[model samples]
Target: MDKTEILNNICYTKLVYDRINKKLKSNYSKTEIETLLFAILKETHEQDFQKIGKNFYVSNVRNNIKITINSNTYRIITVDRLIKTKK
Candidate 1:
Protein backbone atom coordinates (compact mmCIF):
# COMPACT_ATOMS: atom_id res chain seq x y z
CA MET A 1 0.00 0.00 0.00
CA ASP A 2 0.98 3.64 -0.40
CA LYS A 3 1.87 6.09 2.34
CA THR A 4 -1.53 7.71 2.74
CA GLU A 5 -3.39 4.42 2.81
CA ILE A 6 -0.92 2.95 5.25
CA LEU A 7 -1.02 5.94 7.57
CA ASN A 8 -4.79 6.15 7.46
CA ASN A 9 -5.03 2.48 8.33
CA ILE A 10 -2.37 2.51 10.99
CA CYS A 11 -3.33 0.01 13.66
CA TYR A 12 -2.08 -1.18 17.02
CA THR A 13 -1.81 -4.65 18.49
CA LYS A 14 -0.76 -5.85 21.93
CA LEU A 15 2.19 -7.85 20.65
CA VAL A 16 3.39 -4.98 18.53
CA TYR A 17 3.43 -2.69 21.53
CA ASP A 18 5.99 -4.93 23.16
CA ARG A 19 8.07 -5.04 20.02
CA ILE A 20 8.06 -1.27 19.72
CA ASN A 21 9.11 -0.83 23.30
CA LYS A 22 11.88 -3.37 22.98
CA LYS A 23 13.10 -1.87 19.74
CA LEU A 24 12.99 1.66 21.02
CA LYS A 25 14.31 0.63 24.46
CA SER A 26 11.92 3.06 26.09
CA ASN A 27 9.03 2.67 28.50
CA TYR A 28 6.62 5.05 26.79
CA SER A 29 3.01 4.23 27.40
CA LYS A 30 0.87 2.95 24.56
CA THR A 31 -0.97 6.24 24.28
CA GLU A 32 2.21 8.25 24.38
CA ILE A 33 3.87 6.07 21.76
CA GLU A 34 0.91 6.26 19.43
CA THR A 35 0.54 9.97 19.87
CA LEU A 36 4.19 10.74 19.39
CA LEU A 37 4.51 8.46 16.38
CA PHE A 38 1.42 9.82 14.66
CA ALA A 39 2.59 13.35 15.25
CA ILE A 40 5.89 12.60 13.59
CA LEU A 41 4.30 10.76 10.69
CA LYS A 42 1.79 13.54 10.12
CA GLU A 43 4.68 15.82 9.31
CA THR A 44 6.14 13.33 6.82
CA HIS A 45 5.81 14.14 3.15
CA GLU A 46 5.20 11.83 0.21
CA GLN A 47 8.91 11.40 -0.29
CA ASP A 48 9.23 9.89 3.17
CA PHE A 49 7.73 6.60 2.08
CA GLN A 50 10.42 4.10 1.24
CA LYS A 51 9.44 0.56 0.29
CA ILE A 52 11.95 -2.20 0.64
CA GLY A 53 10.90 -5.84 0.35
CA LYS A 54 7.62 -6.28 2.24
CA ASN A 55 7.60 -3.22 4.47
CA PHE A 56 7.41 0.54 4.15
CA TYR A 57 9.96 2.56 6.08
CA VAL A 58 8.54 5.97 6.89
CA SER A 59 11.32 8.18 8.03
CA ASN A 60 11.40 11.50 9.85
CA VAL A 61 14.84 12.82 9.11
CA ARG A 62 14.68 15.75 11.46
CA ASN A 63 14.05 13.34 14.31
CA ASN A 64 16.48 10.80 12.93
CA ILE A 65 13.91 8.06 13.19
CA LYS A 66 12.39 5.35 11.03
CA ILE A 67 9.07 3.61 11.58
CA THR A 68 8.55 0.22 10.00
CA ILE A 69 5.07 -0.92 8.98
CA ASN A 70 3.88 -4.04 7.30
CA SER A 71 2.84 -3.34 3.73
CA ASN A 72 -0.03 -5.79 3.82
CA THR A 73 -1.28 -5.30 7.36
CA TYR A 74 -0.44 -1.62 7.90
CA ARG A 75 0.57 -2.56 11.43
CA ILE A 76 3.52 -0.92 13.04
CA ILE A 77 6.32 -3.44 13.48
CA THR A 78 8.85 -1.31 15.29
CA VAL A 79 10.19 2.18 15.90
CA ASP A 80 13.85 3.03 15.70
CA ARG A 81 16.09 6.00 16.22
CA LEU A 82 19.20 6.46 14.18
CA ILE A 83 22.40 6.06 16.13
CA LYS A 84 24.19 9.30 16.61
CA THR A 85 27.58 9.62 15.00
CA LYS A 86 30.62 11.58 15.98
CA LYS A 87 31.16 14.40 13.55
Candidate 2:
Protein backbone atom coordinates (compact mmCIF):
# COMPACT_ATOMS: atom_id res chain seq x y z
CA MET A 1 0.00 0.00 0.00
CA ASP A 2 1.02 3.63 -0.46
CA LYS A 3 2.29 5.82 2.32
CA THR A 4 -0.85 7.90 2.55
CA GLU A 5 -2.98 4.80 2.71
CA ILE A 6 -0.79 3.35 5.44
CA LEU A 7 -1.08 6.54 7.49
CA ASN A 8 -4.86 6.57 7.08
CA ASN A 9 -4.98 3.23 8.87
CA ILE A 10 -3.34 4.52 12.05
CA CYS A 11 -4.63 6.91 14.68
CA TYR A 12 -2.90 9.89 16.25
CA THR A 13 -3.83 11.90 19.29
CA LYS A 14 -3.09 15.48 20.28
CA LEU A 15 -0.64 14.25 22.87
CA VAL A 16 1.36 12.67 20.13
CA TYR A 17 1.69 15.96 18.28
CA ASP A 18 2.57 17.78 21.45
CA ARG A 19 5.31 15.34 22.26
CA ILE A 20 6.72 15.50 18.78
CA ASN A 21 6.87 19.28 18.87
CA LYS A 22 8.19 19.51 22.42
CA LYS A 23 10.70 16.73 22.14
CA LEU A 24 11.93 17.28 18.64
CA LYS A 25 11.28 21.03 18.35
CA SER A 26 10.83 20.51 14.64
CA ASN A 27 7.38 22.02 14.33
CA TYR A 28 6.49 19.31 11.90
CA SER A 29 3.08 19.54 10.33
CA LYS A 30 0.58 16.71 10.58
CA THR A 31 1.19 15.82 6.97
CA GLU A 32 4.90 15.57 7.59
CA ILE A 33 4.37 13.33 10.57
CA GLU A 34 2.04 11.14 8.61
CA THR A 35 4.57 10.85 5.81
CA LEU A 36 7.26 9.85 8.21
CA LEU A 37 5.01 7.31 9.87
CA PHE A 38 4.13 5.93 6.49
CA ALA A 39 7.75 5.37 5.67
CA ILE A 40 8.32 3.62 8.97
CA LEU A 41 5.37 1.31 8.71
CA LYS A 42 6.25 0.47 5.15
CA GLU A 43 9.43 -1.15 6.43
CA THR A 44 7.70 -3.05 9.18
CA HIS A 45 9.72 -6.22 8.93
CA GLU A 46 13.00 -4.36 9.24
CA GLN A 47 11.87 -2.17 12.10
CA ASP A 48 12.26 -3.18 15.72
CA PHE A 49 9.17 -3.60 17.86
CA GLN A 50 9.42 -3.75 21.63
CA LYS A 51 6.61 -4.31 24.06
CA ILE A 52 6.82 -1.60 26.66
CA GLY A 53 3.66 -2.62 28.50
CA LYS A 54 0.22 -4.07 27.99
CA ASN A 55 -1.09 -3.07 24.58
CA PHE A 56 1.77 -0.62 24.09
CA TYR A 57 4.65 -0.90 21.70
CA VAL A 58 7.74 1.09 20.85
CA SER A 59 8.73 0.81 17.25
CA ASN A 60 12.22 1.76 16.26
CA VAL A 61 12.12 2.55 12.61
CA ARG A 62 15.54 2.57 11.09
CA ASN A 63 18.35 4.01 13.19
CA ASN A 64 16.66 7.30 13.87
CA ILE A 65 12.90 7.22 13.72
CA LYS A 66 11.05 5.94 16.76
CA ILE A 67 7.43 5.95 17.83
CA THR A 68 5.42 4.86 20.85
CA ILE A 69 1.96 3.53 20.17
CA ASN A 70 -1.02 2.16 22.02
CA SER A 71 -2.17 -1.00 20.34
CA ASN A 72 -5.63 -1.02 21.84
CA THR A 73 -6.43 2.52 20.86
CA TYR A 74 -4.13 2.68 17.89
CA ARG A 75 -3.08 6.03 19.23
CA ILE A 76 0.40 7.35 18.71
CA ILE A 77 1.88 8.45 21.99
CA THR A 78 5.01 10.06 20.64
CA VAL A 79 7.36 10.34 17.69
CA ASP A 80 10.98 11.39 17.65
CA ARG A 81 14.35 10.82 16.10
CA LEU A 82 17.02 8.99 18.02
CA ILE A 83 20.24 10.75 18.82
CA LYS A 84 23.17 9.37 16.93
CA THR A 85 25.72 7.60 19.06
CA LYS A 86 29.39 8.13 18.44
CA LYS A 87 31.24 5.02 17.36
Candidate 3:
Protein backbone atom coordinates (compact mmCIF):
# COMPACT_ATOMS: atom_id res chain seq x y z
CA MET A 1 0.00 0.00 0.00
CA ASP A 2 3.01 2.24 0.42
CA LYS A 3 4.88 3.92 -2.40
CA THR A 4 7.65 1.35 -2.26
CA GLU A 5 5.18 -1.50 -2.50
CA ILE A 6 3.40 0.04 -5.46
CA LEU A 7 6.64 0.57 -7.32
CA ASN A 8 7.76 -3.00 -6.54
CA ASN A 9 4.49 -4.41 -7.80
CA ILE A 10 4.88 -2.71 -11.15
CA CYS A 11 6.65 -4.96 -13.69
CA TYR A 12 8.30 -1.99 -15.30
CA THR A 13 10.10 -1.10 -12.06
CA LYS A 14 11.82 -4.47 -11.89
CA LEU A 15 12.66 -4.48 -15.57
CA VAL A 16 13.93 -0.92 -15.40
CA TYR A 17 16.17 -1.71 -12.45
CA ASP A 18 17.56 -4.84 -14.08
CA ARG A 19 18.34 -3.08 -17.33
CA ILE A 20 19.74 -0.04 -15.60
CA ASN A 21 21.90 -2.16 -13.32
CA LYS A 22 23.33 -4.01 -16.28
CA LYS A 23 24.05 -0.72 -17.96
CA LEU A 24 25.65 0.64 -14.81
CA LYS A 25 27.86 -2.41 -14.45
CA SER A 26 28.87 -2.12 -18.06
CA ASN A 27 30.63 1.24 -17.63
CA TYR A 28 27.63 3.51 -18.09
CA SER A 29 27.62 6.72 -16.07
CA LYS A 30 24.75 7.80 -13.84
CA THR A 31 23.39 10.11 -16.51
CA GLU A 32 23.62 7.34 -19.10
CA ILE A 33 21.81 4.92 -16.80
CA GLU A 34 19.11 7.49 -16.15
CA THR A 35 18.65 7.97 -19.86
CA LEU A 36 18.63 4.25 -20.54
CA LEU A 37 16.15 3.56 -17.77
CA PHE A 38 13.82 6.26 -19.05
CA ALA A 39 13.83 4.78 -22.53
CA ILE A 40 13.20 1.28 -21.22
CA LEU A 41 10.37 2.51 -19.00
CA LYS A 42 8.65 4.12 -21.96
CA GLU A 43 9.10 1.05 -24.16
CA THR A 44 7.85 -1.33 -21.49
CA HIS A 45 4.73 0.77 -20.91
CA GLU A 46 4.19 1.31 -24.64
CA GLN A 47 3.62 4.98 -23.83
CA ASP A 48 4.98 8.27 -24.98
CA PHE A 49 7.88 9.84 -23.05
CA GLN A 50 5.60 12.58 -21.70
CA LYS A 51 3.10 10.14 -20.23
CA ILE A 52 5.84 8.10 -18.65
CA GLY A 53 7.28 11.18 -17.00
CA LYS A 54 3.98 12.27 -15.54
CA ASN A 55 3.19 8.87 -14.05
CA PHE A 56 6.66 8.17 -12.66
CA TYR A 57 7.66 11.37 -10.95
CA VAL A 58 6.25 14.40 -9.19
CA SER A 59 8.03 16.81 -11.48
CA ASN A 60 7.43 16.89 -15.22
CA VAL A 61 10.39 18.74 -16.64
CA ARG A 62 12.35 16.92 -19.31
CA ASN A 63 16.02 16.24 -18.87
CA ASN A 64 18.41 17.84 -21.30
CA ILE A 65 19.69 14.48 -22.45
CA LYS A 66 17.73 11.72 -24.15
CA ILE A 67 18.17 7.97 -24.75
CA THR A 68 16.85 5.40 -27.17
CA ILE A 69 15.37 2.01 -26.33
CA ASN A 70 13.77 -0.38 -28.80
CA SER A 71 14.00 2.41 -31.35
CA ASN A 72 11.94 4.77 -29.16
CA THR A 73 13.37 7.81 -27.44
CA TYR A 74 12.87 9.04 -23.87
CA ARG A 75 14.08 11.78 -21.61
CA ILE A 76 15.29 11.23 -18.04
CA ILE A 77 16.78 13.41 -15.37
CA THR A 78 17.89 11.19 -12.49
CA VAL A 79 17.58 7.77 -10.88
CA ASP A 80 16.03 8.87 -7.59
CA ARG A 81 14.19 12.13 -7.42
CA LEU A 82 12.90 11.77 -3.86
CA ILE A 83 16.43 11.51 -2.57
CA LYS A 84 19.53 11.87 -4.74
CA THR A 85 17.85 14.14 -7.29
CA LYS A 86 16.08 16.42 -4.86
CA LYS A 87 16.83 20.08 -5.41
Return the TM-score for each candidate structure.
0.84, 0.67, 0.27
Model 2 stretches with alpha carbons more than 4 Å out: 1-8, 55-63
lDDT of 2 by residue, 1-87 (tens): 133333455788766776787877778898887776766765665325655564344455354667766655656777767767789
* Each model's lDDT: 0.84, 0.63, 0.37
Deviation of model 3 at 74, angstroms:
18
Instruction: Give residue 22's error in model 3 in angstroms.
Output: 6.3
What's the TM for model 3?
0.27
Which candidate order results from sorting by lDDT in descending order? 1, 2, 3
- For 1-87, candidate 1 gives per-residue lDDT tens digits of 466687699888898788878887888888988998888888888698888999888888887889998888888888898777789
On residues 1-87, what C-alpha lDDT tens digit does candidate 3 reach at each position? 123332233333335544545533465655665555545443332232322423433222243222322212222223432223557
Least accurate 10 contiguous residues by lDDT in model 2: 1-10
Q: Look at candidate 1 and tell me the lDDT of residue 60.
A: 87
- Winner by TM-score: 1
Q: What are the RMSD figures for all models against the true structure?
A: 1.7, 4.3, 11.4
- Top lDDT: which candidate number? 1
lDDT at 82, model 2 = 77
